[model samples]
Target: MDYIGWAWLFVIVVCIVIEATTMGLTTIWFGIGAIVAWITSGLGFRLEVQIFVFLVVSILCLVLTRPIAVKKLKIGKIRTNADSIIGECVKVITTINNINNEGTVKARGQIWSARSFNDEVIEKDEIVCVKEITGVRLIVERKK
Candidate 1:
């Protein structure tokens, strides 16, 4: 085979390896283009023509298929137990006085350090609804 054919084979192998390792739609199109270029070279196409076809085919495949492939393979965020706690009510185990920056609560049988959402004082034993979580601290507001 000519140098163009060897180059095409090399490019095809490299692109396939990259696509296999990443599985991220990064280089599979290049592999397809390399295959086309290899076939064109074998059919007696000029080196320049082979290279041009390779580039055009690679770009076309990538542009036409990438978005569709990505959309089909898209993954959604995985929810966790902590994500279920938003808006849940819990009883204060310690006074919630954001002015003093002290608070604790019991929810789902677990104690969580907490703070009042609006900095208002929440007495011990008061019920509060979880608003959000910041690091390990739960931001809460008194349940009306």
Candidate 2:
């Protein structure tokens, strides 16, 4: 085995091991691509062409099929309900008025101080949707 072939093999093996550790399949495609490069190296391709093949295939796998990994891999939060209210629907317990950003909302059955995405206070009994969360404050918008 020549230096080019050895290098390609090494690259493939390392990528595969990393892919195993993460199991997201993000780098497994790269590993497969590297194996392709390794096979090409054994077929008398120059180091430059092998490297090019390695790079092109790796990038193609990453860019083209990245959505597969994105869809299969769920990198969501496993935290408590408090952090989960960011996307929940809630009813305002206090009005969100101008000037002062003071309001409350019942989110997931828990009352929390809610702030408008505009930083305004929401009025009581108003329905709002949680857009996102910031610390203990909820960034909400009027339901309508």
Candidate 3:
């Protein structure tokens, strides 16, 4: 209708394009906001009111829906085999000395480079619990 309506339409199109390309569940809310703004412009609302509605609606949509959308879409980190190894008990194949930076452990029938989680020396053949994996190395702690 008016120039403001055309501008709001442009915003909506740009937001939709960005959302499609990224699939990030972010810009779609802005597109929804722009649609409302476009309707406001068509209804002869002032420019300031239209812009304020756009911003408030966009922020509310994002805050309210983003978390639910992420949970439903399973968009966060996916667990892997390495993640599964955390908290597993393994035998130290080599003396674990964080100061020396030399150690290995056997877990799930495979040997992995190891480090002491608390910087304590672990003797070979001792049982240790896998605490975390960093790069190719497993951070371990003495089995209690």
Clash count for each candidate, listed in order shown? 0, 9, 0
- Candidates in order, TM-scores: namely 0.62, 0.56, 0.73
Per-residue lDDT of candidate 1, residues 43-108 (tens digit): 999989998999999999999998888788872334468867889999999998888888899989
The local distance difference test score of each candidate is: 0.90, 0.80, 0.94
Best model number under TM-score: 3
Better of 1 and 2 by lDDT: 1
Per-residue CA lDDT of model 2 for 45-144, tens digit only, reads 8888988988898889888887776666653324566666666778988886546767888876778877888765567898899998888887899887
Clashing pairs in 3: none
TM-score of 3: 0.73
Ranking by TM-score: 3, 1, 2
TM-score of 2: 0.56
Expressed as tens digits, the lDDT of each residue in 1-144 for candidate 3 is: 988899999999999999899888879999999999999999999999999999999999999998999999976556678889999999999999999999999999999999999999999999999999999899999999
Q: Which ten residues in a row have the lowest lDDT in candidate 3?
A: 74-83
Off by over 4 Å in 3: 89-95, 104-113, 123-128, 134-136, 142-144
Ten consecutive residues with minimal summed lDDT in candidate 1? Answer: 74-83
Clashing pairs in 1: none
